[model samples]
Target: MENATPSRTALGVARMRALHQFSPQAGLFRDPYAIAILGEAAPAAQELEQEDERRQRMRLFVASRARFAEDWLAAAVLRGVRQLVVLGAGLDTFSLRNPYRDLSVFEVDHPATQAWKRKCIADSGLAEPAATRFVPVDFERQSLSAELAAAGLQSTAPAFFIWLGVVPYLTKEAILKTLSWIAGVPGSEVVFDYSEPAANRDAAGQAALAFHAARVASVGEPWISFFVPAELAISMGELGFDEIEDIESGDIAARFSEAPKGMTNNSGGGHIIRARRTA
Candidate 1:
């Protein structure tokens, strides 16, 4: 999150996605551009083959969340949603692989990260879809609503938002504010992931959380928010989201991925949720 520098965590997540490409279980959610998008930074086959339990769990979760979000998005498109806004889009290839020709995809991210993504895309020789619009806004300094509005996002129409790998990094107030904005769009839907408080986690989960927290903090992006599932669901309901699907960690792999043999689902307290504003 340092000024003028792309997020290190973003790059790390991208690497995980790249590693998943080499997974035999990739049929669950194939991202052909996942490795190519990273250009030279893509993980070597050796790295993919030698992944430990923790990294394997992380990789599957990342892929599962994307699968969950996109499955919901396909349903939204059928329901007449045209706008697809990717909040905190970090080297995500959804826009490139979009099957809905009419869907307008918006990639929203920090200016530094956005710039870096553009460079990577260009260097990788991947053609960005014409419908993909990049909106650069530093959430700390700029107004998301204002920036999206100026970038041709229709406020009057419903838009589907995919906010992944971002909620835990934001304060509760900021999270509510953003959700409130999404609620204002009639029939809007959003898919996002969040983690529960350490207290709610099992002993093994807490140990994993501590390690990951310290790692991210060392890179200057310490997680600042954790939500209890029921409380977060209530808050979303208050924001006008009538239908909510909360998928816990244990369920994610079963729901999305064809787990590799002996793959233990040790995803800790992470959860992926999809909320809809029907009214």
Candidate 2:
């Protein structure tokens, strides 16, 4: 990871997902094309599949959040949401697997990561879907609204956004600005994950947190923001989101109660939050 790129983490997530497909406890979600997209790099990625228990736990959470987000997207489409914006899209396969022919999937990510994903798609011999559009932007330097508009996103339409693996790395100001912007848009709902306030964690939790924190930081992306759930609820309410549902590990476990005995749910990790702007 010397020339570490954010896209590498995305690949890591994809590899984890590929491993999950073969797990005996697997069925929370399926991505038949994940391994295929990795192509030549897959054998090495597969080798790391059994590296450590902590990594396995991380993978489970990654896959679980993805499954949860995709489930919500499907539900949103049913409710007539025609636009899907994937912030920090990375290697997500939702666009390719999309069953809704009319749904417009906009993938917004850093230029380098977006380029890499496009190359992966090409190498896999999979043509990018006509309904899928890629919008490249530096999250800290560019305007999301401008980028999306340039990519043909309709501001007036109801949209569902999936923002995974990006929030904890962003500063609080950036997070609030993005949330406020999303709230300003009519009929928009976003699902993203955020870490709990580190100060609130127990000794054991703090140790686990330090381990993972060091790992990401070593790769040049550190977790800089966390939220207390109650405080986050207030923030969302103030920002104009009519509905907010923050799903914790316990809730995720209960939703997928059939998970295998070995599957680990790290309560110390982050939780997924869904916020909607109805008016």
- Which structure among the candidates has the greatest lDDT? 1
Top of the candidates by TM-score: 1
**Residue pair clashes in candidate 2:** none
lDDT of 1: 0.88
How high is the CA lDDT of each candidate model? 0.88, 0.82
Worst 10 residues of 2 by lDDT: 1-10
Candidate 2 per-residue C-alpha lDDT over 143-178 given as tens digits, one digit per residue, 9 for 90 to 100 = 999999999999888899999988887889888998
Candidate 2 lDDT (Cα, whole model)?
0.82
lDDT of candidate 1 over 39-89, digit per residue (tens): 889998778768777777778788889988999999999999999999999
Off by over 4 Å in 1: 261-267
Residue 95 shift from truth in candidate 2, angstroms: 1.0
RMSD of 1: 1.4
TM-score attained by model 2: 0.93
Worst 10 residues of 1 by lDDT: 259-268
